[model samples]
Target: MLTTLIYRSHICEHFPPHDLKEMVNAANLKNGQADVTGILLFNGVHFFQLLEGPEESVFNIYQRICEDSRHYNVVEVFCDFAPHRRFGKAGMELFDLREYEREEVLQSVLNRGTSKYQLIYDDRALQFFRTFVEATEKENYFEIPPADSWAFVSDDNSVQSASLPAEITTECSFAFQPIVDPLAQKTVSLEALIRTSSGEGSAAFFSGLEGDEVYKADLKSKKTAFALAGAINVGARTLSINLLPMTLVRIPEAVNFLLEEIEVNGLVPEQIIVEFTENEVISRLEEFTSAVRQLKAAGIRVAIDHFGGGFAGLSLLAQFQPERIKINRELIRDVHKSGPRQAIVRAIIQCCASLEIMVSAVGVEKPEEWMWLESAGVSHFQGHLFAAPAFEGIPAVCWPEMLSAM
Candidate 1:
């Protein structure tokens, strides 16, 4: 469980190159004993470094780094978990970005790590850290990604419980609703809606779930979503599934479970869009954003579910861009008949368009409602008008014949 801490700051005016190396070398000696491995990059002005080791060791080193008088205005860029150490050792590797050519520095950073993509973040971060942390809450400095993103791949189903292990099976299930694009006359993606096997609905099924139960339920549904798609050989269209952001933070293994299952089901991360609802209050915006970044880094798309339904929905988008936004039904309903609603819907479409985000108009029931929304530049839609959600698997989308006339 190696945690990575990244920060950038300005080297004080007086420190010479020789003196800086001596200091870093001395720290490297001390860090090796603490099992920390990382790279320090100084570009003559700013000092950018990454620290990786046990969670406590990394944070302790960061605290010392923050207190050190050799550098001033130290800004923490990212604190995340690395699946494996990029450098593969317990000592500081120095890179003077100023002394070397761009290729040399990049190769040094990618050494022992994959060439595909490794999280050697922000040498791009000095300016971002300068602005990003200030504009957002400073307490956010403490949130880090999980220790190991693959730690929760529990295939050993041998549960020895007081009750029969078989009795511990989850009662919750899922139904999928397809998001349609009328202009293309094609079904776009399937959104997995949670349901109860007992026919009690999502509210009743998930009512008492808290802590680990929530994570278990989410992991189960996410796995099922992947399984269903694979079983049907669904195309590259996104399989949109709802995710509880806080649950990922609470137990990062939930994320690991999903990632593992994606491989098992012969699916790629690009085909999935994890949606967080607007109804849930974002108590820890920084934590939520970090989890989203982890997902994005894994090639998974993020979306805002039932958007514009809460204050946090639109306001939070300006900070971190998502791949999709499903317009809340309340705003989409009767939009053709209501001038204010249409205006609101238009503004949302424009905002999403500006961000280059796909907009899916959810709850499009009436033909008039669908017409106005399509004219307003929205191509993605889903609701009872197309077809009601079907349990166990995706139901056929009843494409309207009116689309042919149009």
Candidate 2:
């Protein structure tokens, strides 16, 4: 299939301006060999490029561009299939926006198009070029430093020991990982991640279950999570637990059962947060919302987990705003180097901020990922970089400090 990928990046300081001509010449030869054609636009500060060709070739060339040391802060702006190429005339052409007047830049871009009809008709592609030339999206382009800019040091504190009551033992166990504000040096909350009694992850525990058994196991696991949290004396700090949305609908008196368990375990409902993964299909919305209402009524808070993994997250937010939302790991992985991910995360943060909702970045394992997220207005974080999940105990959190070089 014919595909088009658009991206923008800032030139590195070490990349001399005179070398741009040689770079364009090199790109022309390489792209020509792969039957690819596109245009590169430089607006003095940023380089916006479009690549179009066979799906594999386009992606392969784009990957090379990302690894190129000549530029940084690369953000993918648009990507999709096109019936025909817009810049089919060249292997790779250069359009220096610095040379044209603001009003003339748009016309210059249109004139380079392979098809006048395609250029006039393809509003999305044209608008992208126009936006770059007009310097309209500069405000949203956050240029974060490299991830290794700071050092993450783990505090070698011992995990607090707590005995689990015999009655609370179950087929599964709980692993605790803290969501911490590294700069503030405070643990915001500890998420009780479910695991098999054998110390396997949640997927292994759920793999054996089918149908309603899955929901039953999901709801039942939280009881153990609560017991574990209480044993550790979480005190006034909040405790987060994951729940499949359908579990609330499938299990009757689910909210009441949770309240009873919390009370019996010596934890207040106010300190509990039930995180619902967005990927699950809520076949019965009314019933699930009703259960969420009961949770809120009892002082328990609600949060959406895996916020961008599915289409339903925004709809869920519109229906009922949660106390916080965890941005999925897919978006957080190498986010400091990904422009598209950065844009999406920024949008999510802005939307949550407007609604008075908190946001957290989960599954972060890289210092760069955490640093970019922290700069993007996210304070609460859960990931291996801070602390890995410790089965039945709390793990020591890694705190961030400036490197001596800084």
Candidate 3:
């Protein structure tokens, strides 16, 4: 969970900066033991922070923070099961808003305001504290607050909870469907599928195409780009882009270029899911992991595609720590029939869940298969039952729509 602590107090005024540094160091020592990563924000007279890590670490820090003799109007601006970790490491980063030229940017963008060291506890002054932290980070820096103007921060135990929009809680249940070959009773989406360029295609379309000449030509013909453009034109919210390890090694510039296009076309990196094949990723795990880390750092979501197909170990999973893991279709195809296979898959999913990682089953085909997967605690599914990778466009549908359509 992404836990944030907004302590609105005159603690800064009460303690000297040197003493505050010592207290922050102490806090960091406690956090390191608990494996928490967060940033501390201080605006001279006030203090606020966005903490991300295990729940226990955050809670422990909150309890300690309240005891410190800093200023008193403590508030928790945001908290939630963050889609992504905000900070890379566990440390207390101090940001002084007084340094920024445009203080209004904090107020206007994040809804946080500042005041003289005296009126630190005024309710109005505390309103914009989280906003400032969020604007500086420029990410979904906080959980969506419950209301537009105010959020409740329970001081009883420093457990911070925000009031989010009602729609946020009810909207968008995401699910996946298997990709199947209608002719082959045997599923094929589990295999590592690479993008190939065909003759008469745009250079961009052929940028990373490989494999059979015919397939390469087909991919190069601007078909995929046109299809993706069309999907966005029609309001498609997310796009899945498959990348080969060779592509990262061979066409690094092209990868950056496509990422730029994705951003230019009105999609954030978070909306573009990049899938990496096992063979490709495992061959150059370090390079692949580095690339994934960079992409993730840039807010692009990464998926270790075709997981469990190759000799990938749990160590690899720990190393990359991707936001999503798509189990190789082979694992899904015969998992129900093989106890050992099922056990391994279950273990992988359980491990991922513990890390707050999302597990998606790929290449599902039958209704019974879906039911079995759901029972196995799979959070998302993708297969032919959902839709094939077509040049037509990404379908506009919800998780329930896909499920009911099946």
TM-scores, in order shown? 0.56, 0.90, 0.44
Q: lDDT of each prediction vs. the true structure? A: 0.69, 0.85, 0.51
lDDT of 3 by residue, 1-406 (tens): 5554443333444477656677778877777777776656666655667665677777777777656545543434444564445443446555566666564535432322212322343333234443454444322121111111222121121111132212212111111122332222212222112232221223444456456542334323222442334332423344455666655555445446656666654556665666776777888777766666667766777778788888875667766777778788887874543334555777887899899888888777554445446657774667655453332223321122122222
Of 1 and 3, the candidate ranking higher by TM-score: 1
Ranking by lDDT: 2, 1, 3
Residue-wise C-alpha lDDT for candidate 1, range 213-280, written one tens digit per residue: 87667667676667666665556877888877777777766667789988887888888889988756
Candidate 2, backbone clash total? 2
For candidate 1, the per-residue lDDT at 77 reads: 55
lDDT of 1: 0.69
In model 2, which runs have C-alpha deviations exceeding 4 angstroms? 117-121, 158-162, 168-170, 207-217, 250-253, 279-281, 336-340
Instruction: Residues 149-175, candidate 2: write the lDDT tens digits.
Output: 777788875376467755456588888
Q: What is the lDDT of residue 215 in candidate 1?
A: 64
Worst 10 residues of 1 by lDDT: 152-161
